[model samples]
Target: MRMMTCRLCGSDDLTGVVDLGATPPCERILTADQLDEPEVTYPLHLRVCTSCWLAQIPPLITPEETFTDYAYFSSYSASWVEHARAFVAGLDLRPDSFVVEVASNDGYLLRHVVERGVRCLGVEPSVNVGQAARERGVPTVTAFLTPESAQAVVAEHGKADYVVANNVYAHIPDVIGFTEGLRTLVADDGLVSVEVQHLLTLMQLNQYDTIYHEHFQYYTVASAQRALASGGLTLVDVELLTTHGGSIRLWAAPSGAPSQRVSDVLAMEKAAGLHDISGYIDFTERVAKVRRDLLSFLITAAEEGSTVVGYGAPGKGNTLLNHCGIRPDLLPYTVDRNPYKHGKFTPGARIPIFEPERIAADKPDYVLVLPWNLRDELIDQLSYIRDWGGRLVFPIPTLEVV
Candidate 1:
């Protein structure tokens, strides 16, 4: 694939900061019958824009190919459900208010909005997830969010009072078009809250596994502000979140919205050297250390006559496993709560995925928590592993056996 320009700034002056070699499409888990088929892999190379300091990968895969018939279901996660509930409870909503969620996966968050008697709509590209949302009584449009789609939504149901985009910002390749949709769909006095994994946290914690083809852009406060502003939205508030390793919930609106905490967050990012290339220089080396540490741990466990299994079949887990060259010989099999992925194999690594019961049945010596961002939650759920003297392992940031 040819190298492309930056998504945010449209600048050609991009520097290669980190490369994870070639990796399979993160979400394209396969069934056993298809294992013998040839699978395509793309370069997992990340580039930083010298002008805007936005860390992104070239859009090698189109949005349609990535999101259609998606396998990720948000409602399977207990903590994420509670997070959605808390967010809904905090919202100052009335029965008549309109709430719209972009990339609303299976109405995981909008169900709360609907239960509150508020009118809610979900815009999802994936047909299966969008159908699920509709079956749950949430109004859903099965299409990607673009300016044209946003205008149609506004014309049909009127402008939304609150637009919530959680964890969808990073997946957008056309940042301008997606943000334009936000601007077009929102009311004059409407509020928009976007949650994205903070680039600062990704670097600080060595969470390089989060780098995937689907995640086209990684944003800092400064880069996010620039992208939003380009689409005629102004950042108003920024709240740091502990979810997804770490993230920033940015509140935005039309030009006249109050700047509640935007300046403070920007200042913090600038202080952390996110405004320049210096902050990104040592990231490749840090990521390499994580790869080495994880492989060493897994190899040592195998040599000592212990078995190591994985806990989750997340997209990030695919990146980590493929990058570290892990296969069934090392991890054997992993498990996930999502039944859609239960019978499938992880892309690239082709590790078989089973139900959570398999972990208890196998009684492995170590359970590598692939989704380390949810380490606390997974540990609680799989605490029964401790009954058999099995420990949990975290690979990113550093190797930790708990």
Candidate 2:
């Protein structure tokens, strides 16, 4: 389903940025029984809105089909857990102040808020993670955060002092509705913090793998501010983060002046040509070069009789694999810390997934770090691979063996 209009401003003036070709749902890893069945693939093209400069993909698949049984669990990454803790610690919240996290998976972040005696509720759409959150003593509502859902939450739990939307902003197709819900759920002076992958970093670092069906939109500070303004919110402050390659944590309020950081970030984006259509013209070529570079490296490795396996089975990894058309012959298997992904095959690529210990047992010649965003942590964890003279490979930014 191609989008006829821009998701943020509903402008028909959309320009083609990059077409990653058709790809299976990024997180739709298959079991042995389901492997034989035909898998559906959707177009993974990105369009930049000329009016708002928002780079986005059409909502090809429904939210239910993509997220009802999510495979990506937040708590699996230890560094991410510590990042969440630090975020919670930075907030000055009273014990009675309510903090609501949209798309809070398995209570990873909210548990910190709960530990501080601050009231917290998580609006999670996936039943498995929602249940997991409940089990972890985090009150969770198993529903997508829409305007109606927001109203209901406000009625039950009162207006939230802080509405945290971390890394889930890009997954939503109904951008306006979700933002409007944020307006309704938050109090007049309450804060709404949204963290999303920065579009500048994606284009600058050639992070084309992040483009997928689940991520309906890619945001720059300018585009994000305009989208938030539609929901009666003002972009108050901005904080740049190194997570997910690079991301921007936006602090918005119903009524507040834009901070210096917000102005500076927006100025930087403007200076970088993100506000114009011409700025995105080179991205397609860059993405193609990345694909060629990776394939060349993998082919060279195969010719040298070196066995290569993947480190993580993340959604971004699936996109990278499918886009590069890598199969088991080049990269035999991948290991993941998340047990849910074990015993499953990556979507489209059909690479087998096993526990991280499998790398130790098999001792593959090279470990392809799939989730390149967490390369540091993965490198440290799998340092023993170096003991066996096994090198680590990173596909994004450039094909490099470290």
Task: Using lDDT, give the best candidate's number.
Answer: 2
Clashing pairs in 1: none
lDDT of 1 by residue, 156-227 (tens): 999999999999999989999999999999998999999999998998889999999999999998899888
Put down candidate 2 lDDT per residue, 1-402, tens digits, no spaces.
554799888899999999999999999999999998999999998999999899999888988997898998899999999999999999989867999999999999999998998899999999998999999999999999899999999999899999999999899999889999999989997999999999989989999999999999999999999999988899999999999999999999999899999889988888888999767989999999999999998999899998899999999999999999999999899999989989999999999999999999998899999999998888899899988999999988998998
* True lDDT of residue 395, candidate 2: 88
Off by over 4 Å in 2: 1-3
TM-score of each: 0.98, 0.98
Full-model lDDT, candidate 2: 0.93
Clash count, predicted structure 1 = 0
| Cα lDDT over the full model 1 | 0.91
Candidate 2 residue pairs in clash (backbone atoms < 3 Å): none
